[model samples]
Target: HEAPSPEEHLQARTSPLRIEPPFCQQTDDFAHNSTLHGISHIFPYERGWIKRCLWVVFFLGSLTFLLFVCVDRIHFYLEYQHVTQLDEISTPAMVFPAVTFCNLNSFRFSRVTRNDLYHAGELLALLNQRYEIRDIHLVEDNVLEALKIKADFHNFKPRPFNMREFYDRTGHDIKDMLLACHFRGTECRPEDFQVVFTRYGKCYTFNAGNEGHTPLITTKGGMGNGLELMLDIQQDEYLPVWGETDETSFEAGIKVQIHSQEEPSFIDQLGFGVAPGFQTFVSCQEQRLIYLPPPWGDCKVTPMDSEFFESYGISACRIDCETRYLVENCNCRMVHMPGDAPYCTPELYKECADPALDFLVERDNDFCVCEMPCNMTRYSKELSFVKIPSKASAKYLAKKYNKSEQYIAENILVLDIFFEALNYETIEQKKAYEVAGLLGDIGGHMGLFIGASILTILELFDYIYEVIFPFSHVVYIGRNHYSKERGQYFTSLRKNCLLICSHIYQMLAL
Candidate 1:
């Protein structure tokens, strides 16, 4: 419709029309190309653009910032959780105390060491003599743990063992045909267990042992003198608790170790997961293997010959001053006949002296003579092998003797077991089947590397987000925020950066 004059249109429209601003700018003729008010002219436009840009950037930045904050907070929560989780089973520090640990090597009963036993090959050969076998396989394990015996001396090896060699790797041949069969397990992979020998912790080349959590002497006092808790025939169901992480609950932690006579788990592959074997040695022995108990009851003893002593991990060992049946002096001595044998006359003088008889005497003196560690079954026997007292008995003793319950429980009870073990009148010593302990390979670097790689990547992602997205500033348009308290903030930032770097490094490693 054609509008009237400007004055008439103004008069007709009573409802004041909303006026839209002009899209283009206007200027006077005097305003030259070098306009002085151009900035002023663009000021309003810039304000509008600035506001819109600010809204968009700040909105996106706030969202991203919120998401990042949530992520970081969650990360910290999880990190603390994981740290706490790990705290339960924190890597077991060297808990094997220097207390003269009762080495199985010295036990009069299981007194067989690396030198005392036949090789797996010999045993296999014996089996060959009995049965027709296609290929006789012998897995070897050393009895006289060269390592455990010399643990006190050095942690250095001038020449490292080639872990892949045949002769060096073969351990002492344990002659338990039954254990060998069981070790074969369900997996009949001949290649997997080719005379392979596994060792636990640092204890290696130990004396062969039979059954249950083999006892060792240590300083850790539990329930009583740590020795007694382990000896009694009475076994308790020790609740395995998480001993590693700081978590109060032991759901997944290394269990609290306790002494018991027979909790198959304790002596089996796993149990009170406190002690674990470290390096594994697979050995095959061919020659004669004979180990005599040292003058001292301790299985791991200093060798007389420095060279031979050094080979079994004993260094700087002098001849024990208390050695009565000195093997070094009686070399090539033959076993005396029945009449020629030294009579069992308990006298101060050396009544009888021969290799075989002295071997028995020396070991008896080293360990306990009257209280032998062998089979103590008969009632009339002097050494009973039943000293381990029941908890009720110990408790009764504790109440009666007015002693500490733990003292009664552990120390006295263990003494009781020892007392019982020694009661047999004639303890017959024989070679029994040995079940060996093998250390775990779980916590090593090579195993954790794969899993750690993934965690490192996630850590890196967090860092890169912080760096690229800029934790402080919301946008490049204008500096809206600044992270102060430089030390902590930067440290966190650095850690994130480092984590990311490590992740990248892992990828490279991969």
Candidate 2:
């Protein structure tokens, strides 16, 4: 071959086909332009090793702090903490709460039939003896003796009895008990009250809103502006057979509960007592509560299959749970419980249902897992009382009712229920750490420490992926066409060698 010139030699040595690794060039460009703090300083040729080391130390310290704080924040968010806040709002008018009242005496002395009395007395005696309650003195000594003989003859096993029918037949009538009624300076009739069954047997609820009637509203507060009632709680008509183990019910009074129109009344458990011979005033404040569900709180939304109640509440859930337990164990339901199961007869009640209910209350209460409702309305009440039938009007009242002053004083009470103010209190529970807040905190820490944003983070990931997995044909050194097998073999060998060297360098650095 002829000797080549100097130009030809230079051109051949610096030919475009002469291959060089592109990774180093690409890395240098990325470092110069990247938004990551200290990256360009680490790679630049002019920076001294000492200055680069200092920058690396500072960047690494900041990154360590950021990581620690971010980890703590993430852990806190996962814990699902909550906060409750209370706020009061004023309103022009507020819906009056439902008022449910029941007589302390569940049955009339003269209204119960002999057979009904005997069966009820036997059941009561069995219950009192079984539960170690007070002695049962419901019937006369002669009747007691006869009951003992009958019990011995039948081995103390009770017969079936209809408790619902008995209660309906002998319970106090609303017409007779509500002697006077007024609402917001207007007269209210007994027909306006709806009948509801509760643990206290028959009870009456005003403004229940169940008969397609809208709830009553009040624009004013204080006594005489809401519901006013003069009730006759006839002490003389109270029968010993109707008393419960709890001595609180033995006193002559009316049990009253203030609740939402959509909720069912649990009178025996939630009611306050209004004693006869007193003018009782109940000042109520409406409260609306909103609670978060699941990961944030234990509150539950009302399910579509809520069968017994129009709305969901803790009290309603408890009642349903108890009813289900009773039906499952005893195959019967109580008079106060709502279900399609047959009413628990006196025999079954004494034998199975009562004990099951007791067990549920005393030991297995946790079995019912009734979570609170997410949104609910509640009433907080403040009560005050003044003695009624003043000395000046005692005689006139006695003459009008055709009863003695003592009898009137012992049998009559005035009840006034009104709002404390035309305002509603809101209680709300909220998440302390939300997803948005978490992301914000993380972003703030990232920017403060590494001088990086979301876009910078994406750019870093893209750079890494491109470096680790380049195109198959990209590893070739020269532009000479080769067989596919040869190209693939060279590509694999170069990639393996680069990865091995990178790993060795990382290990040595560590």
Candidate 3:
């Protein structure tokens, strides 16, 4: 070949080459070798124009459909749908729930000291005035006069009352109230019960397990397998002067609550009433629940931070919230409220704490952000009662207690609490669309619609990085290093393109 002149050489260098770019060759090779179906047909070398058009149309349509389905699935996953399922599990033994019982009449009239009676009557009168019960006048004027207090309902200021001392002295003794107690065919003593102050003034709880005591467990299921109590409601000790006007508080019976040891007793809200002259049988079923935390659920994974409680629960949270509200507004806490704050005097209770609690219930219930616990145990009960003290047993029991048959029949009751079965129900909240399930669904759809898999996706990404990255890097380097003239830029680009083609050709040869 003849050596070319400088002008000819420069023209040849700037001329646009007919050869396809190196990236175009790489793309063609990828299409032919890709595991993805229908790609090779779209890039066929010798196919007619009509066939090529059809293949392009079909591939793009299917690809668009696949993309739409994938997006829909992804949207569904992002919504974080959940499902709840119930399963029953048999257990060798179940922890016995805390059993708390309170007298309908908080104080025994005969047991009330003169000082306690005086203070209690004042407290009751204030409560009645606060609730607008219209029965405050029933409090003896002599007693009010003895305390040197006027009967003005609105301006009532109570004497300093020691609520815990008064309630403990006047409340029915557990030793006297529990005529008989048995657990699992063994006799239980009054010492086994712990004193728990509640809305009912002073109540007794069995198996509370809150003071580092070991929890009680029951292996057998059925009536009489757990706790059985013969209790005296002390009807004669219920005085009209100490009556409460609250609707639920007026009934003549004992209020009983079944709860987890971790939770405090909320007797007024959660207790069941068992009237005298009836043998009450409570059949309990334990339910254990597990819930997922966000984004699947709003359940809390850690115990809520609180000032009064060591464990977190809805009831505990509400109690803490109420204590905070009361202390913030009234500078004191209620007797049943858990806190180290000074107990609300009867006057403060009637004027400020009571109204604050009512407001909390009526309007500010959502003020406390009590999230559901991720794991919780709950007890559900079914109650059945049979008339106690039959004609034959009434006289026999009356002789044994030296009381009238009528008194025996009216004042005594039997309570039986036992598990319905040793099996517990588990209710779990689970993510219906987990990440793994979503990825599996995506893979299935890809394989079904586009004949692609994880491997195919990886191959495509590899092809892009290998081809486009080097090509882009070369163009960036040429632009930065070459002359500003358009022809010089084209000449640099042509040289880089040739270099890429030579490398690709050597790769193919290998």
Worst lDDT window (10 residues) for model 3? 125-134
lDDT of 3: 0.79
Sorted by TM-score, highest first, which candidate order results?
3, 2, 1
Supply the global lDDT for candidate 2: 0.79
Error of 2 at 271 (Å): 1.6
> Could you tally the backbone clashes for each prediction?
64, 0, 0
Tens digits of lDDT, candidate 3, 1-510: 898644455455544432235766787899999999998987777888888889889888888988999999999999998999999999999999999999988766566444443444445543233333235466466443433332233554445558667677778899888899999899999989999887678899999886778989999999768999999888777744445332124678899999999888888778999999999999999999899999999998876788788888878877888789889999998777887898876567667877778777787857766889888888989999999899878889999988899988889999999999999999999999988998999899898888999999999999878877776766775565554567766665677677667767888999
Worst ten in a row by lDDT for model 2: 125-134
Error of 3 at 293 (Å): 1.5
Candidate 2: Cα lDDT at 183 = 100
Clashing pairs in 2: none
Better of 1 and 3 by lDDT: 3
Considering only N, C-alpha and C atoms within 3 Å, which residue pairs clash in candidate 3? none
Tens-place lDDT per residue, model 2, 1-510, is 798644455445435333335777778788998999878887776779899898889988998999998999999999999999999999999899999999987777557554564466446443243332234455667544544443342334444568888778778899989789999999999999988887677889999987679999999987778999998888766755434432125578989999998777878778899999999988999999999999899888648345776667877877888898998999999888997989987778778877888788778857877788899999998999899799999999999888899988999999999998889999999899999999999999999889889999988998877676553334443334344346665665566566667767888999
How far residue 341's Cα lies from its native spot in candidate 3, in Å, is 1.2
Q: Candidate 2 at residue 276, lDDT? A: 94
lDDT of 1 by residue, 1-510 (tens): 885643343333321222212213322221222122222323344457766566556545544654565455545443322111111111221121111111111111122122221211112121122222213232112312331332222343333222213222222222310011112112112221213121110111121222332333323222222112121111111111212211112221122112221111111122222211111111111111122232312234333343222222111121111122333333221211111222221111122232334355345555312222111111211212243245556567567656555644432222111111211122222222111210112212212322223344455465445454532233432222123344654454566566567767888999
